[model samples]
Target: MTKTVLVTGGNRGIGLAIAKGLIANDRRVIIGARDLASGMEAAETIGAEAVELDVSDRQSIQRCAEYIGPVDILVNNAGVLYDRRVLQNPGDFDVSMATMVHGPFYLIQQFEDHMRKNNFGRIVNMSSEWGSFSEGLLGPNAYGIAKAALNAMTKALSAQLPNNVKINSACPGWVRTGMGGFTAPRSPEEGADTPIWLATLPDDGPTGGFFRDREPLGW
Candidate 1:
């Protein structure tokens, strides 16, 4: 059976790569983006449906959920990175957190019931290695903090999910994207591998884990 998959921020970057990967596997994919034109164009390219979704906006998320309906796989790949330091301007921190953490958290809560009822689901939260407090790397304060919170949210949701449902976080590493900039080592295709792996995991796969390149990574 073709699984229903939804990838947020699918118009570009890692999200777009993941969408293409799923499409190649013949999954029923939907590309969600903040821009309708870009989203539709991406969807057309990947043979997927397009839905308008701005992770920071609750109304947009609601509309996308209503349009896509229940999906077998949900990829929370939308994120924002603030280049400023914590002391630079604390207000920007809230904005980053709202998009990176709160947005995905609320969407997970909203779609969780559908997963529960279906008794089968896969949720892959896009996280970052910079979020690893254990690693002691703290450049982008807002981005790091938000991704750490996102990882925690993934763990919490995994615990609440039924045996048939699985939720995990994937760290795409330093990929060359608009957010990652041109200096990053990995390509979007390489960055997307871990997310696609987690999304298409078997029923027996691990949950509540943080991974990169299909291998568990330090939180």
Candidate 2:
């Protein structure tokens, strides 16, 4: 049976690459985007389905979860970068946390019980080295802070989930996405590699860990 995989922010960039790779691998893929038209366009191009999901909105996240029911896997890839004035503007920090931290948290809560009942599931949080204390939480504004919270959640949630269910954080290095800019050294496909790997891990695969390029990374 084919597993169903939903990737947030999958209309473009590394998320799109991950969705395409999953489709190619015989998984039932769904691309989530803030814009329905673009999401559908990307889904049609990639032979997958599309769902409207604005990770920054609580209502949107809840509605999206209801609309998509149970997914075998989830890729929490949606994110945004606020201006350098995060401290100067409270809304920037709020939006950052709402999108990256709270949104994924609610999505996971909505589906984790289903996964536990099925005794099989995989969750990949599209985290970054910026979230790492080792990396100095270096991402500008609240980006790193939000992702660090995400990484912490991944570990916390993993403890509550069953053995067959796996949840891990992945840092897709600077890829040539809009966020990564044109001069980035990596391609979206290259960035998607480790994420796709984590999404399809065997039962014995590591859980509650941070990784990049399929190797362990410190948080």
Ten-residue region with minimum lDDT total, candidate 2: 81-90
Q: Which segments of candidate 2 are over 4 A away from where they belong?
A: none
Cα displacement (angstroms), candidate 1, residue 193, comes to: 0.5
Candidate 2 lDDT over 1-219, as tens digits, reads 779898999999999999999998899999989999999999999899999999888889889889988988999999998757787888888988998999899888878888888889999999999889888888887898899999999999989889788999999999998898999999999999999999999989999999999999988
Candidate 1 least-lDDT 10 residues: 132-141
Q: Model 2: which residue pairs collide?
A: none
> Which clashing pairs does model 1 show?
none
Where in model 1 is the C-alpha error above 4 Å?
Answer: 137-139
List, residue by residue over 1-219, the lDDT tens digit for candidate 1.
Answer: 678998989999999999999998889999989998999998898788989899888888888888888888989998888787777889778878878888887788778787888878898999988888767646387888888888888888777788678999998889999999999999999999999999988888999999987988888
lDDT of 1 at 211: 96
Best lDDT among the predictions, by candidate number: 2
